[model samples]
Target: MSDFFIDIIDDDGADQGQEAEVVSGSSSTWKIAIIDDEESIHQVTRLALSSMVILGRPIEFLSAYSAKEGFELLSSDDEIAVVLLDVVMENPEAGLQLARRIRQELGNHNTQIILRTGQPGYAPEEVVITEYEINDYKTKSELTRTKLFSTIYTSLRTYQHLVAMEQSKLGLQKIIDSSASLFQERSIREFSEGALLQINALFNIHSEGIFCISSGPLAGDRDMIVAPLEAEQHRIVAATDIFKSYFGKAIDDIDDITTKQTLHRTLASKEHQFTNKYICLFLNTPSQWEGAIFIKGDIDEERLDYELLSVFAMNVSLGLENTKFFTQLTQMAYYDMLTQFYTRHGVIDRCLNTAVKNGEIFSVCILDIDYFHEVTESLGFEYGNKVLVSFANRIQSILPADSVFARLHSDVFAVVVFDDKPLDMEFIAKQCAEAIHVDGDKLRFGVSVGVSQFLPEDNLSGEELLRQAEIALKLAKEVRRGGGQAFTPSLATESRGRIQLLGELREALASHELVMYLQPKVSLIEEGTVVGFEALVRWPHKEKGMIPPNDFVPVAERSGLYYELDMYVVEACCKILSEHSELTRIAFNLSANSLNRPELVDDLENLLARYGVTHDAIVMEITENSMAKGGIVIDTLERLQSKGWLIHLDDFGTGYSSLSYLLDMPLNAIKIDRSFLLQLHDSDNAAVLLKGIISICKDLDKKVIVEGVETDSQKAFAMDAGADVAQGYLFYKPMKLEEAVDLMKKQS
Candidate 1:
């Protein structure tokens, strides 16, 4: 074993003890290896270079005696910057062979090699330097202290440059990889966070920093760069390292005064600022937004290439612009502008991503605002918008923080709850029921809600959940408005049945399976003489037999099929009038939806002309609710009345039975609903209400037809009440065309 000792040689050739600096404690150090068989060579070299510091780092020496040991030592520490090898150690060509192994076997092209030899005759310096990848070659006798120091200095400098170049290459590659990822981010905050991490990796620094932005047009204006700003204008969008907790805070809220000042200067100047202790990079976006990243730590100027940083900054700016654009497009697609709630598409996406995809249980509730059109029609649409906004705010206030609320249609909104517990639908209903104050007026409206649950066991998609909820909503509106219902299997079955029946009804209309049945309207003052007949629609299915009107009428009304059905009824009545002249003034009911059609009068005129039926022979019966609609319905009635058709208000006491409707509508007669008659025998209020309705119709000079008179008492009450006509089972059941024609002949 070779013992190591540090002996400094003087000019007199006496050895002197020299103490080496304590460089082992330094965080930054340059590692060098001395591979030689002679212990004296190691001692002298260590004595000479022990006090040397290059590039602000102390030198760390590693010793290996034999060529094999040197190879092992170099293989273990690739960071060894410089290697000094002695020729003729263990063998004449051992140093040469080890050099080849270091470069070829270990693939270490970085460590600088210096060769020293005592036998210049054995190995020529030029040949050895060229073939062995040696940086410097010297004879031992020629290597004075001055030459040794100069050679070591040059080799260390060369090694430093090579390492820096390699680091630069890696950093640039990192920037390229990071730019690709940053460009893919569609969120500004996410992109900023990723950019901060990449910046840290690019410079190989562990520093605290924040990414901040000032938004709006003024932020991007070059002229406004130096203007005084509000403290809250600069928002910290992302943070890294110790500044992670500072995210979303304003720049002024940062505790570090120096960091805040530097960031403010960088943003105000719209330029990059680099100091000995920190770095601030200003980023410009295509939008009216400016941003800055403040890194609080010393950066090596050698690694901080201005050109590379410019390229990186340009990429970050493009990424920010792309993120902003995509974010805006996303908001427009997923959020409603007026209410700032999620749109229908947004709600479905949330359900899929946050619940259904994860197999989590959730529930969906849909709300339809009843009588919404009246608000828009009575007030202006702008005022109606305020009401909708108020209603949305109320709903949002009552929902859980995690719930997703959205506007699905003009008057329909939806809520998606993530919890597995049953939704408190009554609470939602009560919240929505509160009156909305719009423009100093308390506008009251009813909200009908339908709810459905999503269970992993059910295996339903988000759209299917919404469909089920809508089915329940339709039932709520039909069974009773201003209430809520949860989805049941029976509702789905009924919906499917209605859908099937609607298809069949369309086919029936085309095939003429639907026919008009008439019941005689007898005059009470004329000793029960038949004056006219009320036409009713009846469907006789080829296989299922006669289907009652009640079974399909509501279905048609809900499905928007009532218009076609009403037109069919009108044409049938025209056809009957043309065929039998004795059957005159046949009255058929028109639905509220049918009355709102702009072409109703024109279509009726065409049908009458086609059948050669006069206008006086046909009567149009609309419900009291149709009169209450008051806009298109009233206009349509007036147009028909002006064209000489008799208009009768049917089901008067059934819906919206306001006396104002009797005065406002242009009606030739009013038919009391059978519901009033059913109560009249048992309740005195029913009799008094019926009497009052008939007296009002008489005072208005409008004829009164009493419907559903089944027994003698009902018939006597109709005559005593001075009703102009009575139509019931007692007079004649709704009969076929032949029976009706025979009855008309008998009455004549």
Candidate 2:
């Protein structure tokens, strides 16, 4: 055993006398060499140490008649820990030269050297001890058995301490290096296992054991223990017993579980005979662990385990805590908030990896809700959210176990089927649409599915697959009714055109690529006189011939690019109306999404207030179809009216023309649908319906305007039906702001 190990065992042992004897015995086994020209001195030193033994090993003596013999003995056996030499051996400086040569020439730093002499008068104690590489000096007469034994023991103890310190330094360095790589571990099991190994090694403890506390899923698993061989079977048995005692019990009993506090104390009080074979060098109180390391040797006799374990416990706690936090955070980042499914980014990452490995044949399907925005506008955002959530749940319920779903955006979702089966993919898509039923009100959504198969060694990533599926979805949407459209490479060419249009759309609002056209609302009393103008939004694409608002409006809303467009439109209206003070008040229409914004009223008020425009001058025309069913739509419209802005109910007869809203709404004007006028000559019902609408308006004290009049007969009919104003292509088609002003001047 090393001298350092002996000292630790000695100091740490509770039985002081027994521990001292053990330490002495253990130290005595280290060989001690004596070099002098005297045989009597060696015999005397051996007698001094004869009674001492370090553990079971006894100290043996080697006597040398000259320095040459001492050097030869030390050279042959490297285990010699100490050398006692005389300064005046064969010559006065011979022993001094040997000491220097042993350290410098032979590189033998392990051996401890003690200089002794018959005459100390020649070499003083301070000079011989310092100038030469020797431990101590003693006179021949002072070399009694007790002193000699004391000197040797003290020297060995000092040497042992230095070796131990060096080992501890290296261990600390390894711990620092190991701790840095903790995050790189693949699994919690692997991380815990590696940490235990590093911690035990750091303490220079070959006998320690570690185990984790089992909780929740691991409740009954008692065999889950991590430990080294030195911990022995007793620790394992004790741990199993400890676990079973509290396995199903509440955690409140954890405080009073120590054997030392209860079992050992009781045994001692009763004077009962007990053996300590199972006791270990873990004298310090054991910390509670779902798991723990049990030491089996005399813990009070060895403080190394206790002190080292304290440090290990701190490191392990920090590592485990970090692992848990990172693992949870990683999961949350990859999942969708509403569906608890993989997000577009997460699904794409998984697909790309699968494609790279070329293992399973993966197929991707893109599904879009048919006219979903119409429902959102009609039923309200709250109901729309419910429908979306229900859609996700239904897909999860019916999809194959191997398939995965992701919400790509508002109305578009993607599902990746593992098996390359087109029939299965189509069935799942249809099931998702059909399952969204709410009693009498089954959801009215149609799904367009796009199918594409995974290719081996495909440079195409998830992003490319999404693009291909989107192309197929576009083809499906073009069909009007619900159906599946398989992806073809030729579709990518048409997709490129749409992508290019999208890029231009991004700059459309910013660059004023979108132009407002004013359509004249001419008076029925006189053909040339204009009553009002309807503001229309038109996007003129540089590459594609004029892209209709219907084609791009939904796209803008889906991409969250509608807010910018809405803000720009509101701001532009403020500027345009601020210049047009001559014509009757112009009305600009807003989408349901814009009206639902809590900040819409504030934003609109601020813009008008900035330009010094009165609420009466600018009319906010919201379609009845859009605002009829949304929760906050009525409240928002009332709030705007309360702020003194005129609200016009546009597209009056198209959808959900609630009589209650027509009677109760705080609207300034209502535009009659032109369908009644087109069939005025053909049907008497059209005339009767128009008269009923006119009578309702007259009763409500609201002004009436009629749209889509293309001839003199329709305009005259509107004027004859108690309509206050009339507008259509016969008056003027939508024209540019400047052109509308010119036409107004001409009419005036």
Candidate 3:
């Protein structure tokens, strides 16, 4: 055998004079444990492996004299790579039991075990190796210096492979987790910093780096032109370690020429460049900005997984693209594209945030350009856009620096001023009144303003405050085109009441709460005989008592409910004519909106047919304005007159009375308004005007019905002026169907 083993065998008793020395642990050494009942074996094994090294790491020898001592030593030191176990200690199966316990109890599966026994017959090699989880089985005589070196070297190499695989698994897991965290960043700079940090962690290196971006075309550009890297065009968005101070500076400002050149080359080639000294990872996004990450560190080129790095780079690119898309969406949402002002939603958010910060009173002003539609209709929309932009600029110049200005909608802008005083609306109007130069044309426009205050005690939300301003704006437009109005609590109250009444009115129509009342028209020449009756609609509210026509008629018109109301009146009149033949005819008024309906004639005829009433029994009365509406109203009137229905112009002298309507319209009669009769007692000019109107109607072959003749002097004057009909309280007031029937019975 080798001299090393001859010495170990011959000098068996020599170790009795000395103890085996214990070696301290080290990161660059593989731990080995020697366990046996004989101190000579421990000394011999330690001497044989003292100068040996495996996988570039020296051995750390831990000596134990018995199985119990070996178990204690191995349990305390988990880094032990290989154990030389002795079979016969205090008991025959002591080494066998300790081997099983090391694999099971201590759970040190990675530590390789080699069983050696001086009495091989006591523990058979096959049984001990199979039953005990031992890596190798050998007799003490067979374990010479050569075999011992080969066995320990092979076991230590195996342990090295296992540790490397475990570290690779953990590093890959960390990469996946870091990728997820990088995607959560919303800004380019934030994402870059996270990427740099994650890469450093992946390699376990504390390196310096800079993330630089160049302004140019994006990933999917057709031309694929990359802008020249000027000092202003290239920006270092993120930096780490020694390069942290270089963040937001130009890439050219980097003192290292190698780093700057590598970044430029990587971006130009659109590919990653890996080297022993540094790594340049190319990055491209959908935002048309190309970039690169320059990391200054030595990475193992042969060991680096390029495929895994590419996957991480793809995730970085996607994260950058997502951030760019989100930024673009935010810009579109918060700013007006044309005027570069805050949009309505952006302004409201600003107002809410400001209110929370200041907790002080402020005013919101809404300015609407008057006749803006006319401007768009006369000029092209392009020109109109220029006017709008110029107008916004003018208003913005006059406002305070801290004020929030927004474009609410077309031709409407809003302003939120952080002050107790309201905006000087008159001065704003005057400023906008100046002519705007658009395409070499001077265009003058007026603005109407509405203001609403936000009081902390009122506890109004931003949306509610804006709503109140809009309400005042509507009133300003109605009160005067170029004036301003402040919001009042009564206005909102009145608006709410109107809305409630409208809802109730709709229900009233549906449930038959509206009743038809008739006021008799008498013929003075026939000694106060009841000639015909005028149909009037009255609402007997369940809560508010009787609602007059003046109260609800305008509401119906404004709400587009006048058509249904008019048809209801017509149907009621037709029913009356069908019920009592003595009531020869009934006259009911039609609003201008109702008269303009295409189905008005058909609806009226259908109602008459349903009630079995003759066409001549229904008289369609419209105001002068309704007749003067000219196209559909006049055509509908002529159609009804042709069908044997008389069309009377009611409230004749009240609105826009045109002589053309009196002469050219299909009118069978004219009812003079009540104002003329009321004016007769005040002036003789009223008498002359009334008589002249009656004379003109007579000459035009039309009958005259004098309405609202309440006094004796009015009745006498109507008869003397040759009026065909006189409707007044002097004859009969408006009453229900039962009362009208009783009055007609007395007349009969």
Candidate 4:
């Protein structure tokens, strides 16, 4: 050890490289503090070891003339790695006391202390060194320049190793905790943040830094994670408190352009790049999102950063990729594939979950694209798809931030808005109408809107709220030009009543609670002579004495029960015709809904054949407006005409009457509506209008029936107008189907 120290302190100033290496062990500098009473002791110590180097660093000295001064000097500076103390200072125990103060009062366990004594009997090397926690003990006679260097070198090296071990313990612990969080965490932003936290702990860096992800997906990446952003740009994913404003900002916007350029190069090269002052590592995960981990700090970590930080980057990158995978999976499950809106099931499922607050209220609105099927059929589904997307975007732009939207069906969209303030559904409906019309107006289309609100008090599911809106939407579609309507109490009441009626009607059909009434239409020339009877359905309920046709028929039409009712009437009329061969024909009514049936011809033909009745024994009556809405009404009517099933334009002079009905529609007769006949006594114009209508029918070689003639004067007026048939109470009243059958039997 003595020869080694002697060689380290070469007096010739030889081996400068060896001197530099032998001083501090590194190119870095280590500070040493010297404490003694004699000025010569401090000078000699400086001269011997000032040029010494350890760990590639040279030694720097700080001196104190007294024990108290030494304590004060060491107190101000903590980086002093080693303290060389003389035992005989201002007092015999001065160096020992200073050592005790450094260990106890200053609480610095890291700085090495070397104790030396000039007197042997005053203090034993074992006693003072053991008692005061001194690092080493030597006498002035033995501490030559070589021995001094050996002592200083050994002490400094031990101090460096101890510090490295302590730092490694703290840094490794922090890293273990951080890695646990990385594996357990799910957010890319949070994972990136933890990366910076662990990096700061490991490298002793406290400056602000940004973690940026600003390149295309990495190799072997099948998912286009960042393709949705404009031109696949890069973004700052996470940052420290001081740099938090940089989050979500583009990499080009970073104030540190040099750092930004370096990150770009690192991403381009797919490798790490280090500068004299900055540390940046490129993270390549097998996903489309590339990242750059950067730090501009007080300490340079480049020496061991690749070895140490590479672990952190690998763990963090895997965590980030997993997070992105989960995020995309969730988006695909909950969002509409075409418009990026919420799916109906997705919104409903979310609402049914525990995420909603206990007392939260939401207003739900539904928008329907008017004649959407027509648009899709005429313009093609591709154009219709564009219209749907455009309409959705417009609605999203019009609604508030917290609103949730979804495409519920092919042409229907559902929206849910939080009710933070007093909900004004009318205003929401208006906004919805406006949004729909922007595209609708250009395309010559229209839309209807209906709105309802969530009322937990009502105990309605999200689906029920949607149903309420649909009921209101049905009413809106009937309105002119198809406008907006909010779900009011009246709509709910009407819907409830209709639903109840539908249920009762279904029950009545099963139980045979419904019966038929026949009103006879007699010729004016043949007094009190019954000819043909019109079939009128009557529902006699146990609860509500009688259900009128006006009330129940409309409900049946709206509820799609009209088809059943029409079939029931046809069967009843066939039974009557099968009983009495003398009956001329029974005319049955056809509503717009029933007239649109695709299987109407098949049904009627089967019924006639089953009952052994000719098609000539039945006359089908329809109002003028009913035919306008059914696309196949004209074709079906022509088919019926060909089969000798007489088609009559019933209530023709009142509803949707057109000259086209006389010229184009196949018709055996026109029945002037009851209104014209009722006004005959008071309004001369009504009488003149009736005469002209009858005249037109005569000119067209069509039969004219004057219906609802309740008085002798109405009958006389009908005869004067050249009517071929008169259906009025003045001739024959309404009778039961059995009574009509008996009368027909009697006539036969």
**TM-score of each candidate structure, all chains considered together:** 0.70, 0.53, 0.63, 0.63
- The predicted structure with the larger TM-score, 2 or 3, is 3
Best-matching candidate per TM-score: 1
Instruction: Report the lDDT tens digits of candidate 1 across residue range 53-93.
Output: 55446779999999999999998888999989987798888
Over 4 Å off, model 3: 1-282, 286-310, 323-341, 369-394, 397-402, 425-447, 524-527, 624-645, 683-685
For all candidates, the clash counts are: 0, 23, 1, 17
Q: Determine which window of 10 residues in candidate 3 has minimal summed lDDT.
A: 1-10
Residue 640 error for model 3, in Å?
Answer: 4.4
Tens digit per residue, CA lDDT, model 4, 363-428: 777788778898788888888888888778777887887787888879888878777554554554
- Candidate 1 displacement at residue 369 in angstroms: 3.7
The candidate with the higher TM-score, 1 or 3, is 1
RMSD of 4: 12.5
**lDDT (tens digit, per residue) of candidate 2 on 660-725:** 777677788888888878889999998999989988897898888888888888877787888887
> Model-by-model lDDT, in order?
0.79, 0.65, 0.77, 0.74
Give the Å error, residue 637, model 3.
4.4
